[model samples]
Target chain A: MRPQHLLHQPLTTQKCTLGCPILDRCLGGAIPCNSITELVAESGSGKTQLCLQLSLSSQLPASHGGLSASSLYLHTEFPFPFRRLHQLSTNFRSSHPCNDHDPCDNIFVQGVHTVDQLLDIMPRIESFIKNSKSRLPIRLIVIDSIAALFRSDFENTPGDLKKRSSLFFKISGKLKAMAMGFGLAVVVTNQVVDLVAPDEGINGLKVGNLGCLYSSGRRVCPALGLAWANCVNSRLFLAKDDEFVHQDNQLVNGDGGDFVSRRTRRWIHVVFAPHLPKLSCEFEITRKGIFGVER
Target chain B: MEISRLPISASQRGKLISAGYTSLSSLSSVSSSALASDLRISESEAVEILKVASRGSRLGWSDGTNSVINGAQNAWDMLHEEESLTCITTSCADLDNILGGGINCKEVMEIGGVPGIGKTQLGIQLAVNVQIPREFGGLGGKAIYIDTEGSFMVERALQIAEACVEDMSEYSRFLRNDVQACQVKIQPKDILENIFYFRICSYTEQIALINYLEKFMSEHKDVKLVIVDSITFHFRQDFDDMALRTRVLGGISLKLMKLAKEFSLAVVLLNQVTTKYTDGSFQLTLALGDSWSHSCTNRVILYWNGDERYAYIDKSPSLQSASAPYSVTSRGIRNSAPRKYCSDHQSNV
Candidate 1:
C-alpha cells in the first residue's frame, strides 16, 4: 500500500508488453494502463472504429504485442458496429495467425444507454474482472463515448450545472479507480463540437501554417468541455481533412447526382498526455482497420 | 457631457483630460492614484473631479432605494421576452429548416468557411434581413454589423435587400395587396439604415467594442442582431500566445453571450478557417479551434466541394448532422437550384 511498493518490477517500466506495433509511435509508446485515455474526434473521424481496433488488438496473443486477454467494450453511443467488428476481426485473424480461441469470444460487449445503467454496470464489470474464473483476464475496457448518456440525461440548466459538475467528477473518479485498481487500459471515446470560425475566406488554400503554438483557428474541439477534460489522463484528438481530394480520384457518380464520394485522410493529434508528446500522426481507415498513414 | 464643458477651470480641465479619457466612463474606470499621477493633481482632487464628471451619469446603486428582487424581477422579465426570441431567417428554406428556423436570438451562432465562400454575404444578408417587418416573417429588429476584416459589403447588402423587396413584391402581387405598402416596408434604403455598421481593426479594439456593447446595446434597444463578420481575423493574427488569445477570446465570447441573453438579441459570429497540420499533412479547421468550439448553440459550416457550395450543420442542439446545398448568387446566398428528382430535391423544392 506504500508509494514505493507501487513502483516495483513490471510496473517500474511502463511498456505495452503485448506490443501493438504502432502504440509506441501513435500513442507515445504503450497503450497506457491504469489510466483513462480519451480518443476524441468529430463524427466519422473513426473514434469508435479505432476503439474497435484496440479491442481486437488487445485480444491478440501476447506474442503479437497484445495482452493475450479479453476486452470489455461498454458501447454507449451506438449499437456496437457488430458488422464492422465482424468484418475487422475476420480480416485481423486472417492476417495474424490465431491458434485457439475465437476473437469474438474474448471481446465482452455491454450496451449502456443511461447514466444509471453505466454506473450500475461498472462494479459488476470490476467483479467480473476480479472473479478470476474466466480463461482470459480483462486487459482492456473500451467506453465508446463516455459523454453520450450524460449529455442526453443532463440538461445544462442553471440549477443542473452543479449537478453536472458533480456527475462529471464522479464519473472521472470511477473510471480512474477501475483502471488503476485493475491495472487495465481504460479507453474512452468522446465526441467533438465544431469550433471552426463560422466565417473564413478560402485564401491560403493549400498552405496551413502551424505558426501559432495553438491549433490554428480550429473550432472543432472535443465535447464534454474542461470539467470532464480534467478527468481523463490522456487525450487524443482525431480529425479528417478531405480538402485534398484529387480530381482523378473521384468515384463514379453512383447516385447520378453531383454526389461523388470524397476521400478523407485522418490525423490523430496527441492533444495532451503525461506520457505522450503533444504531436499528431496521419492515419486512414482501410479494410484492415485503423492504419497509420505513413508519410 | 464633455470634460472641457465641465464647471472646472480650463487649466484644471486641460490637466484632467488625457486623449479620450475625458469621458465619464473612462474617468470612472481609472484609479484616482493613476489619474493623479498623470494629471499632477492630488488624489483627493482627482477623485473630486472624477466624481463631478460622473454627475447624473450612471452612479452605482445606493443602499436602500432599490431592492435586489426588483433588479432580479426585471432580469427575469427580460429573459422571458418570448416576442424577442425570434430568428433572422437566412431565406434558404431547407437551411432554415435544419437550423430550427434560422439564426436564433439569445445565443451565439458561428459559421465558418474558407475565404470567399459567402460568409460575409450571409452576414450582410442577415443584417439586412433582420429589419424585415415581423408580419412579413422577419425579426423586425435592427442589426449591428462589426466588420473586423473590412469584409462587410454595403453593396452586397443592398443587392440582397433589393432581392428581398422583389420577393416581397411578388408575395404582395399574389395577395393582390398594394405595391406601395410592400415597397415601404421592404425598401433597400430602410434596410441599410437599420443596420448599424462599424469597422474594427485589432483584437484590442474588438474586445473594447464588445465591452462597450452592453452599454451601447442598452441605449439602442431596437438592435437585436449583432454580427461580427469574421470574429477571429484580428485575434488570430495578433495574439502569438495561445493562452492569452484563448483567455481574451473566452472573455469576448462570454461578454457576447451575456449581451445576447441580456438584450434578447442574436449574436452571429462569422469565423475564418485555419489549417491544423498533423503528422505530415494539414487539415482545414475552424479558427480558434476547440477552445471556442462549444460556446455556440448552433453552427453552420459553409464549404465548397468541387466548386459547388454547400452548408453543413456542423453542430446543433436539435438538428442531426445534415447538409443543404446552397450557392452565392448576385442576390446573396440562395438555396441551390433543385436538381431533377432526387427525393431530397423534391422535399427541398
Candidate 2:
C-alpha cells in the first residue's frame, strides 16, 4: 500500500479564458474553473450577448489562456441565436488568432429550455467528450437564463416557485458536477427580478417580494435564492450606464435615446470571484454585444 | 516504505488535481477512475494510489483510514453548508421589526401585486439591500436575480443602489462589493439549459440552494431573506397543460420548503392576482391557489386605489391576517399604517 500524503484527487482551481478581448482583461487572465459564476443585469443590459460572446471566446487556444474546448450553451428564454453566434465567430477569428490560420472548431454550442430536459442531456456530455477524440476538450459550459425553464415547465400555480426552485437545485447540482468532472469552466446567465417592500404591513412597512407570483403562497420558495449563490464559486452582475456609448454617439442595440440620461451609463458589477475585487465598471452593448468601455 | 508498493503515476496525479479532488476527503467520495477521467489520466494508477495511501489510518480503505477521510470530508461539507446561508435586509424599519429585524437568511419569500402595484420594485429593493452588511442584518452577500419578465429594470436597481449609497457607512464593506443582479429573459429551452448547467457545483451548493434561507441563516447567523419577484410571469405565459403545471408546481414547492427551514432565511415571493367571479360581483384572487398558499410562510396582496397603495396579509404562519395602506413612492415600497379617518370611510380590509 502507498502512503497517504500524495493523493490530490481534486484540483479546485482551473482558469478559462473568456472570448472577447475586452472582457478577458477584466476577468483577470481567465475565469476560474469548477465553480459557478454569474453574469447578470437588466434586459438589454447585455447579459445574453455577453454569454454568447464568451461561448465563442472559450474556443480559443490555451496558449492565450483560452479554454481551447467546446461549451454547452443552454438557453432559457430565447432560441439559440446561431446567426449572431456565427457572425461573432467569424468576427473573433478574423480579429485575433494564435496561428491566424488555426480554425475555431473547438467550441460547440447547445440550447435547452426545461430544467428536467437539461438534466436529461447531462450524461450525454460525456459522450461529447469521447466524440472529440480527446483532441477538443470540454472546458467551459454556459447557461443563458435558467429561470425561463422553471417558468415555462412549471405551471404558475400557487406553489410552483418552491417546486421549480427545488428542481433547479437538482439540475444545477448536475451541471456543477459535470463541469468539475470534465475540468470545465461553467458560466450561467440569470434573469434579474425586482424586490420591493410588501404593502400589507402597518407603519409604512415594506416587504421584499420574490417575483414568482404565479407560484405565490407556498411556504417559502427560495427558488434560486441562497442555494444557487452558494453552489458557484463566483457571481457577476452586468449593468449598463451612459458611458457605454462612444463619442460618435452611435445607436447601440439596447441603447437608444436613453444614452444621454445620467442613469444611462451602464455598469457591469463584478459581484463575486476568487481573485477579483468587487468592482462595478462602465460598459456598453453594441451591435455585437456587451463590451467594456474605457473611461 | 509503502510508496514503493503504490502504482500511482505522475499523470494520474495531474488528472486528479484538475478534477477538484485536491483533498483526501474529496477523493474518498468518488471512484478512482472518476478523478482519472476528469484529469485525463489513467484510472489504474489512481486506484493503485488509493489502495496503498489509505493505510490503517481512518483515511485508509480497509482500516480506520476510510473513517478519517470521510470525517474530514464531512467536516468540510458542513463548513460549506454553514457558509451557504444567504441573508438580505429589507430597508424598512417596521417590516424588519416583524421579520426579526430584517428578512431572514437562507429562506425563500414571495411578494404579489397588480400590474403597477410595485411587485418588481420590492424585489429590486431587496436585491440591493442584501448587499448591505451584518450591522444591518444582511450577510454582506451578493444577490443572484433571475428576471423572467422582460422588465428587469437596471435603472430601478441603480435607483436602489443610490438609496443604499445614501445610507452607506465606513464600517460596512458590503457596499464596496457590488451585488450582482442577473437579468435573464429566458426563452423556454434556455431556462432548462441553464438549470442543467447550474448543477455542476459541489453537493453542498445544491443543498444550500435547495434549503436556501436556512443556509443563509446559519452563515450570516442573523441573515435570513430571499425574494422571488412575481413568480407568475413565466408560468402564466407557458404551461398550456394544467396537469403539467401542477406536477411542476408540486416539485417546486418541495424544494422551496427544504430551502426555507434548512437555511433559516426569510423567503418573500411576489405573487400575482387574477379576477375571479363570485355571484354578480367580480373579486380578485391570488394566483397559484393552494399550491402557492401551502408553500409560503406569509402572503401579502397589493392593490391600488387611485394613488393610495393598499395591502392585505392573507396568510401568515404565526401572525393574524391584517390589511394596511401603503404608497409606492420613488424611494421604493413604503408601508403606511391605516388610520381611521371617519365612520363613513369604506374599508377594503
Candidate 3:
C-alpha cells in the first residue's frame, strides 16, 4: 500500500463532525484522527476524566461532529471507574438531549495487568475492531497509559533497555498503524516524573506572588523519556493548581451552569504539537467528567 | 618519571597495558615498590614512573593536547578572514549589532531564557531566516534544527515562513527555484523544504545525533547554521547521574565547537533557565550550572523586564555587557521600537 494513503490531512484541516466543546482549547481544532496524541501529566491531573469524556463524546452522531461510534478503553494503570463514566454519559445526554443512546454499550473497556498481557490482548482487540466495524462505530482508542507496564518491568538496567525500547516502539507502531488504517482518534495518557528540585518555597512549594503556587520541582516532563516521547505526534501536559477540594456532584449543574461548590482548576498545556500553538486552558473535573471551566 | 620518557622499551609498555595499568591515574594509585615486583621492573625506575605519573595527572597538560598549535602569523591570517566571515542576521539590527553582526559563523553562541520567553522562537526564526538569499543581505543557506524538548512547531515555523515571504520579492534573485519565470513568487513551502529538522527525545538520541551530525553536514553543505533547541532538556532530565550528564554535556559542547570551526557553521544553542533563590526572591539562572558557563563563545541572556523583552550580552570577550530590547510578534523577533529613541530618553534619566 502507498504510504500516501497514510498522509491524509490532519483533522485540523478537515471539517470535524464531532463538535467537541473544548476542542479549540486543548486541541487546536478537531481531534487528529490520523495521528497518535499523548496526554501526559502528574497524578490527579484529570487525564482519565478527559478520556471518559472523549469516550462519551465520540459516541455522538456524526451530524454533531462526532464519529457516533464506540471507543476501546484500555485501563493499564488504575481500576476503571464505571461510576464516573455513567455520570459523564448522563451529563452528555442532558446537554444534547437527542443523543439518548446508552453510551456504555458503545464503549469497550478492557483492563490489562502486565506488559505481556497488553501485547497479547492487542492483536485480539484489533481483529475484534475489524469484525465489529459494521455493527458499531469504533472511533477513539485510549490506553490509560502506554508507560505503566514498561516503567515497572524495566529496572533501569542496561540489559533491559533494548528489550524495553523495542516493546515500546512495537506498541506505538501498532497504535499508529491502527489509527491510520481504521481512521480512529487515538488518545493515550502518560505519567510524569520529577526532574529536579525547583526554587525553594515556604515548605517545598514554589509560590509566585501573582500566579499559582506550584511545587518546587524543577522539571516535570513526561515519563518514559525521549524514546516514547518521539513516538506520538502531539503531546499535551496537564497541570493542577495547589488548591485541592473534594465534593459531590450535587454541586454541578446538569445544564452546564455555574458550579456551586468550588472545584480545583486544572490546566492543560499543549507542550508541543504540529498544528497547535503553545498555550493552556483552565479546565475542571466534575461528576460529569472534565470540562473547560466557563469563565 | 613518565615511563615512556624514562626510555621504557615497547615490551615494557605492552606488559603495563596487560597488567591493567592503562591510565596514569590507575598506575599512580598503586604502591611503586609492589608494582615493581609485579612488573619485574627495577625498583628505582618504578618509583620514578609513579612519581612522574602522579605529577602528570596533577599538573596541567605539560603533555600536548589534541588541538594543533599554529604560529601567530598563521593565526593572524585566520583573524583577517574572520572579518569577512558570514553571520546570520537575527532579523533585528540592534540585536545583530550586539551579537557582532548576527551570529558569527565560527563561534557557538547561547541564548538563555525561562520557559515562555521565546528562546525557541528565536531559534526557529533563525532557522527560517537562514534561507534568505545573499543578494538581499541574507545568509543564503539552510539550517539544521535539532529539537530536544519537542518544542519545534512546524505550524509556527510556517507562520514565520509565510511572514518572511512577504519581503521575498527583493531577495528573489538569490532564492528563485526556477529560471523559467521572470517574476517569481516565493512559496513558504519551499522555505520549509530547505530546513533540515530532527527531533530527539532522549539524551542518548541527542548524543547520537551530535555524533552523526558531521556526516550529515558534509552531505548537506548548503546548511550553514545548526540550532540545538534547549540542549539541556534531555541531558538534565533523563540523566540520574549528575557527573555523567556533565561529561556528556561537555562532549556535546566540544563536538559543537569542533563542528562550528571546521565547517564554518554558526551554532545557536538554546538553554532553559534554572531558578536560584537570592535576596529573598528567586532569580532565574542558566541551567547546567557553571561547568557549562564557559562552553559558549558568547552568551546572551533573554529576560523580561516589566513589559518589554530585553536581551543582555552576559559574556563576550570582545564586547562589554550590554542590553537591547526586542519583542516576539507574529512577524518574528524584531527591534522594540524606535528603541533607539526610547533608550536615549532612558539613558538621560
Candidate 4:
C-alpha cells in the first residue's frame, strides 16, 4: 500500500461509549476500537462498576455513540457482581426502550481464574466474536482486574519475573491482535501498588528523589509495573476521595446547627492516551449508571 | 562452563564438542586463526564463535571492565545536572524554603511523621503541583503514586488540584504581558489525570513493583515524581526476619534511587514514626530502624509544636537543620497561620 493511500484509508474503527456524554467527550468520543484500554484503580474505586456499565452501554445503537454490538466480560473478580449488573441493565432498558430483546442477554460473562485459563479462552473468545449467531456482534471485551490473576501466582525471583513479564506480553499481545483483527474494544481493569523509595545502601546503584501519587489520601501506583504499562494503548485511573462537606442548616431548620457529612467523591483520570490529552473529570456511580459529574 | 552454553549454531556446537573444545574456557584461550583450521570453519566464523565463547566464559569477559572507565563522568557534568534539577513544590512556601525550593528531583527524600500530621496531604500536593506547566516555574511532569497503606484519597487530590489550578490562574493574571504566561491551559482534572496511582498490598508485591519501576519510568519518561506513602507499613508488620527485610528494603531503595537519578524524577518516601529506646528514655523516630535511615538522601520530620504543625529538616546532605511551620487545610498544604495574630483577634473578640 502506498504511504499516501494509508492516510486516505477510511476510518472504519467504531467506538463503544461509556454511556456518559461528558466522559465520552473527555475520552475523545468514547473508547476507540482496535486498542486496549486499561482501567486502573483500588478495590472500591468503581472499576467493576464502570465495566458493568460498559457491558450494557455497548449494546446501545450506533446512533447513541455505541458500537451497537454485544460484549464479552471476562471477569476475574467474582461473584461477577450480577446483582449490580441486573440493576444497571434495568436502568439501561428504561433509557433505551427501542430494543425489544433484553440487553443483558447480549453480554457474555465468563469467569477467569488463572493466567492459563485466560490464555486458554483467548481462541474461544476470538471464535465467539467471529462466528456469533446473534445479530449483535461482540465488539467489546472486559477483563475485570487483570492484576488479581498474577498477583500471588508468581514469585519475586529473577526467573519468575521473566516468566510473569513474558506472560504479560503474551496475554496483551493476543488481546491486542484480537482487538485490532476483530475491531473490538478491550477494556481491562488493573490493581495498584504502593510506590516506595530506592535505598542508598546498595552498591553500584544511584539514589535520588523519591516521590509518590495519592488517591483518597493514600499513595498508590498501578500494579504489574512497566511490562504491563507498555502493553495497554491507553490507561484510565479511577480514584475516590472522602471529604467533609459542612452544611449550615441552622438558618433553614430553626433548631439544627452546622451539619458535617463525609462524602466520597470519585474521579476518573486519563493517565495516557494516543488520541486524548492527559485529563481527569469527576464522576459518580449512581443507581442509574456511572456518569461523569459536570465540573 | 559447557560449550553448549555459548550462543552459536547447533552444528558449530556439535563440531566443538566433537573436537577437544568441550568447555567454554578451552575455546576462550584459542586463537581465531588456529581454531579456524582446527574446526574446519572460516576465520570470521571462528572469530564469531570465539567471541561468543569468551563472553560466556567467567574470567574472559574484559569488555565490562574497560567500559566502566569509559562510562565515568566528570564532577562538572554531575554539578551541571544537579544545578538544572527542578523541584516539585509542596505548596507551602516555608516548607519549600526549608526543603531548598521544595522536594528536589534526582533524590530520595524520606518524610516521616505521626499519623494525621499531613504526610499524605503533602504527597498529594506534590503530585498535583508537579504537573504545573514549566512556564509557571513548575516541572510540568507526571507522578507515580504507590499506595501501601490504602490512605490515598482522590477527593483530597482533587481539592489540591483545584487549588493548584486556582494558584496558576492567579499567577497567569500577574504575568499578563507574556502571551504564554497569560494562557493557563491546564485544569484541576488534568492535574489529577497526570498522577498514576498504584496500591501495594504486601512487601513482596512492593519489591516486585519497585523492581518494575526502572522499566516503567523509562517508558513514561515524562513522569518526574514517585511517591510511596509510608514505606515502613509492610516492612514493620509480620517481618520477623530482620536481616532479610533489611536486604529487601535496601534493594528496593537502591532501585528507587536509581530511578530518581535516571529519570531525573523526585521520589518521596512517606514513613511512620516509631518510639526508640535511647539514652534511658523512649523518643519518637522514623520507622524501619536506623540502617534504613541512610537509604534516603534527605529526611524531614513532621511534628506538632503546640497548636501548629512544624516540619524539621532532621537530616540532609546539603540542607541545614531548619524547621518550618506548615498546615494542611481543606485546600492543601500552605504556610501556617500566624498564631499570635489569631490569639490577639480571639482575645479581642
- Which prediction has the highest DockQ against the true structure? 3
Q: Give the clashing residue pairs of candidate 3, or none.
A: A17-A65, A17-A66, A18-A65, A18-A66, A70-A137, A198-A216, A226-B201
What ordering of candidates by lDDT runs from best to worst? 4, 3, 1, 2
Q: Candidate 2 lDDT, tens digit per residue, A1-295? A: 1111111322124467655556667766546765567665556667777777776667667766667776667676656777777777677777675435333355565668567678788778767765666456677777777656654566644366445544554565565556656766778776555434433222122112212221112112223443244334466665443433433334554444344434355655555443454354567666656567665
Q: Candidates ranked by DockQ, best first? A: 3, 2, 4, 1
Model 4 residue A11 distance off true place after TM-score fit, in angstroms: 33
Docking class of 3: incorrect
Ten-residue stretch with the least lDDT total in model 1 chain B: B59-68
Candidate 4 TM-score versus the reference: 0.46
DockQ: the better of candidates 2 and 3: 3
lDDT-better candidate, 2 vs 3: 3
**For candidate 2, lDDT tens digit of each residue in B1-349?**
2232223565655555566656555556667777566666577866666664554223344432233333344556545764664435455555554544445554455566654456666676776666555444456544444333322333335545655655554323444453332221222222111111112134233234444534433554432344554455444432457677666656665666665565444556666655443564335567666565676666666765533556666666544566556544455555653445321333431
Residues A1-295 of candidate 1: C-alpha lDDT, one tens digit per residue: 0111111224222324322355346664546676667887777788888888888777666556567778899988766799998998888778776445568878889999897787787788878988956578987888888878777777755435435655655665566566656667888888866545533432223111111112223555566654465456567777776753344323564554444456676777765454333356777787777777555
TM-score of chain A in every predicted structure: 0.83, 0.73, 0.80, 0.91
Cα error, residue A243 of model 4, in Å, equals 32
**What lDDT score is found at residue A22 in candidate 3?**
71
Q: State which candidate has the highest lDDT.
A: 4
Per-candidate iRMSD: 24.6, 16.5, 9.3, 17.1
Off by over 4 Å in 1: A1-295, B1-84, B176-183, B339-349
lDDT of 4 by residue, B1-349 (tens): 6777666899999888888899766876789999999989999999998877765564335432212234555577677768887778888999989888998898999998764467777888888888988988899999888876544545557767888898888888886877765767997767776788775655676888888888777788999999998687666544557798888888888998888877888999998765455665445678778788888779999876655678999999899999999976667889988888746844662
For candidate 2, the lDDT comes to 0.53
- CAPRI quality of model 1: incorrect
Of models 1 and 2, which has the larger lDDT? 1
